[model samples]
Target: MNDRWMQGPQFLYMKEEDWPYTSRENYHAISEVVSVIPTSKFESWGKLLRVTAYVCRYMDALRGIKRENLALSSEVFQRAERVLYRHIQAESLLSELEFAASLRKVAKKTAQCSSIILSMKPYLNENGVMRSMSRINNAKWLNIYTRHPVILPDNNRATRLLIRHYHDKFRHIVVNEIRKKYFIPKLRQLLIRVRKHCFRCKMNVAKATPPEMAILPEVRVSAFTPPFSYSTVDYGGPFDIVHGRKIEKRWICLFTCLVTRAIHIEIAYTCSTDSFILCYRNFLCRRGTVRKMFSDRGTNFIGAEKLLKTT
Candidate 1:
């Protein structure tokens, strides 16, 4: 029956029953009768767009069916058409697209089944058995086995069961025999190199380095202002010469005159505590005694600081 009017009228009737927008003076009267329905889960704009497209396609398909005069038998197509029309009235594009895509998937599955039946002879039996060559071959083999009953390799008959059971073993035996007959013996073989750890040797070589600390030259020590007068002292350079070969590691002593802002940098042969102390004392002698100095918390500097405090 042409029940398209149900889409508009029924939708309006249902909305009225729910009393969705009746919050005026009739609010109490509406609320007494209307139970609020839960909102729809499909709320995304993209989903709506997809559904709309589906409905459009389904409606197009229904139009085609109508043009061909095949609407009577195509019940599903008709239902899809009604649904598409409803979605169109609702202004939901995504719902139409989603439904159309679903219908297309069903059509594709039906086509696939039809194709399979066409390709395979005696396709489906009345009992729903799909007749194929492999099944027919197995049936023939069973008939032969029942009559003859010969003692093959597996019970002396090269049947499907025996073939399946020993196929992999038979394949390996054949390949190995072929290799024995044809493979060259005197050829030099390329061996693959595999890495393996020698546990004993690894344990023997596992020794820890001495805990000698060498601070990087840039580790700055904050000096207190005016009331606390201290200069920041740190190590400097691994300097690169224009001609000399670059050293992997080198050390230089650095002293900053906090008051004068005069920087003293000396290349250190070794960053020993004695060497650092000598550098600090030399700075004090050259440019008046600095009562306090700030430097990185390295072993050498800490030791020098302690020695200066004692003196």
Candidate 2:
């Protein structure tokens, strides 16, 4: 090959009409360069070439547009960048597939006749062989065997790539997709490991631990205490009461004994401080004065407490 071709494609003073010829020449030069590189580097080199082409196109489009058209130039550059980014992502996926394929090959050889398995022959039982019979029947199952015997291996990088491709779906979904072609041992564990490390999945995962239960107070747990020693008060309802031709609304104050779980109900015509005080007086007369009282922090309860304290 000529030194000019070896030096790679260079466009200098080229006319618009020469683009077709120049592109062909560029392709030829790229092929020559690619032939010398290792197979592993091919995907990366192809991605670089695509990005270069996109940048060149972007520059060419910008050249035709006026300098005053900043918006158009920005838009063109952004679109080109997006395309380049996508190409890079695709190249990464291709690399992952290649690595997984290599692992699969190694695993196949190991499964057929591995020194590791022979070493563990003393420990393997008839049950083990019977359990592995299904796996042994299928050559595809060999993909799970790696350098070790008891500890099965998987292409974690490839599995993660597949999971991300499926938008980080549940373990069962990913397992189903993988089982379509290859058998991966502990697939659920593998998926869980990937998802646990995934930033998006971790952020979206709900906390597995439940909220701690509040500690029980002394009054609720004390044994053999009097029924009205400590009481909790709450209001319930607006029941309709019919007297002759007139219908009226009534409310009930519920006083629950913290020790004995006993409840005392008092009637109130209105949810007012005076009405609540009367109800409290009735409760004191019937169940005896409570040493401690718990309430729902209602306005009527607060007003009644202040009135009782003053009286």
Candidate 3:
């Protein structure tokens, strides 16, 4: 029937008691009722009430003439609920078993003796025994048969998991925390490896590796070059001196031959442009004029260069 027919006085005014009683005849009326029922009402209902209501509505929508169809519908619903519950339980159990297997693999790897463990043999209650047992002396300090099954070695699989889970903390922090509950052989090494490879730790702490050295400049590497032909100049410290019963300061202007590695030092009374010009004059008179000079961007050197250019 059309929605207009259902909305008319015939269906709208009809009492629940007057509606079709059997499932075969009540299909249209059940559909209309289900469509009009608010989804909120279904959500608010208890599980039992919800299941009951669902089954009743389903049975009403069935078109079979036999009364046994209602019983079959209830049986099918119950069976489906049981199957769904079993499926969920099976999935959960399967996941747990898989996790346990992974842990067992980790345990086996941890139990194996490594080079580091063998090195500790001398410290095993047999030689150079100390007064107190520490984590370092694993042979005497750890019961491998019992602890190995549960605890991993310092650089093993379990330690990696702990480092990643704990945000790649420092080795001391990770080792100290693990020591409280479990003893892992060479735990420090394992933690270090984890921290080294951990993406977060690498991003935060990694440094750029130095690239290969570039070819030396021609002025620095050339052979048989005259001294001071290519030179670098820089000012050194002011040295205290006694002159006429008064303390005075003098600066050393250092000129270095880039190719020959020869050095020339001249004393300057002050770090002014005039003083630098005088120093340069003394260097040029002694060593000849340099073809090129390299100096830091000092104001005195700049002024001297400008004076030389003008002269």
Which candidate gets the maximum lDDT versus the true structure?
Answer: 3
Give each model a TM-score. Answer: 0.31, 0.47, 0.42
Q: How many clashes in candidate 3?
A: 5
**Root-mean-square deviation of every model:** 27.2, 13.7, 18.6
- Lowest lDDT 10-residue stretch of candidate 2: 124-133
Ranking by TM-score: 2, 3, 1
Q: Pairs clashing in candidate 3?
A: 154-185, 154-186, 154-187, 154-190, 155-190
Q: What is the alpha-carbon lDDT for the whole of candidate 3?
A: 0.57
In candidate 2, the residue pairs with backbone N, CA or C atoms under 3 Å apart (3 or more residues apart, or in different chains) clash, namely: none
**Which run of 10 residues does model 1 get worst, by summed lDDT?**
186-195
- Model 3 agreement with the true structure over 31-94: per-residue lDDT tens digits: 2222333323332223323454455446555655345444446555544333322222223233
Candidate 3 ranges beyond 4 A from true positions: 1-180, 183-193, 196-207, 212-215
- On lDDT, the stronger of 2 and 3 is 3
Query: What lDDT score belongs to each candidate, Candidate 1 first?
Result: 0.42, 0.56, 0.57
lDDT of 1 by residue, 1-311 (tens): 55665555445656566755534665342211001211133433234334444444445574563345533334444343333223232232232223223445553444434332223222222322222322234455354323222111112111222222222244324323322211111111100000013344346568988998886333234344432144677887666545466544557787775554667776665678898877766776666665567777899888877886798
